[model samples]
Target: MLDYKVRTYEEAIEVIKEIGFLPLTQLVPNYPSLDSITSKEHWHTGSELDPWLWRAIFPGDGVAAYGKFVKKKSVLISSELLPLTRSTLGSPRSVNERYQDGLMSREAVELYTLISENEGIDTRVLRVQAGMKDKDMKKPFDNGLLELQGFMDIVVSGTKAKTNEAGEKNGWSSTSFETMDYWAEKNKIGKATIKVDKAKMKLKDHFTSFCSPETMKAIYKIFKF
Candidate 1:
């Protein structure tokens, strides 16, 4: 088994590069779950590692974190492998087609449009601009955001600490997001050099080394390919 004990941001980047993709934490709820096998003690929350610090380093760090559907939160992906991962899901074209076909929900379209127009946005501000500030709209807004992220159309760019009514820092932060294409352009990330089918096979073979057959099936299901 590969060592998952990452104690520093640099170490975390190395791990993500080796694995190609990894959930930020060990508590992912779906198959190929990190919860059972990954040691919690090495997590950002549990250890000296902090996710915010990692995000701060991501601008040119060659690693990125975004929703991957294996968990409720984002997954860390190495820049070298991001294009291949995108290929597995048939991105860009697929996301655009879904939007054109009206397969995307109204909320998702609104969120996408706003992000597209603005380039990038903080979550709190985005919620207000997208008409999702109401408590009742929370679930739909969150789901819509996740939908875009899962489709590889959007990704978390960074974060800023939240402030209270008095404008004091609450020590909690809201994540900021940007379209994947925007991120790629800014980071100089390129498209996959390998064919999509080859990318899928490569990822599958890598996963099989560490995951069970059942988990492998789940990975395929999660990627929808």
Candidate 2:
């Protein structure tokens, strides 16, 4: 029960952040009949979950079968609010890193609040399902998703305001941007030019040449900024 109950992808991330999503997403699928199951996986980077990927399957949870995951050690659990691990696994990384590897949604936030305020269970086993529509947070001053969207727009726009010795300013990760840009050009019908205008950047102007609103939101959320 460690994943947000989400219908659309955005609705899901709007609650749990990210830390609490990935593992739970995959685990639930494993046993469509299993309820309230707790599972863990090897956090490859010892950081947050890769912000770009949100699969309904967590193949890594079967690390025991592959002899890749340790058991009964303190492990970190990730969700929307922050990355934290209180696992019994004695994990090599900190709670923050574990949380990063997991993803959560905003609904998960309300779920946790509702549970803590009522359930009387001091556990963090979140489950994604159909429930009452939780109230929304006020318009975020740009959530992490928008923030990175803007930042990536700047980076992918292929323009830099300032430059390091190599001429770079405010340049975010190029690797992810390149992949996104390539796919965009290949798929987009208009195939407009993707350009970054640093001085004119605004979260409101989500017109990056490559990303759609949903994909932009998803990839940005993955970074957890």
Tens digit of lDDT per residue, candidate 1, span 1-225? Answer: 343554566766666667666665453233322332344554456244654456445634446645544445667677877887887764546555787888777788789889888775888999999888999999999988878877778877776778889999887677777888888878889965577788888778776677666566766775555
Model 2 TM-score, all chains together: 0.18
The most accurate candidate by lDDT is: 1
For candidate 1, the lDDT comes to: 0.68
Full-model lDDT for every candidate? 0.68, 0.26
Quality of model 2 by C-alpha lDDT: 0.26
Candidate 2 local Cα displacement, residue 49, angstroms: 17
Among these predictions, the greatest TM-score belongs to: 1
| TM-score attained by model 1 | 0.78
**TM-scores of the models, in the order given:** 0.78, 0.18
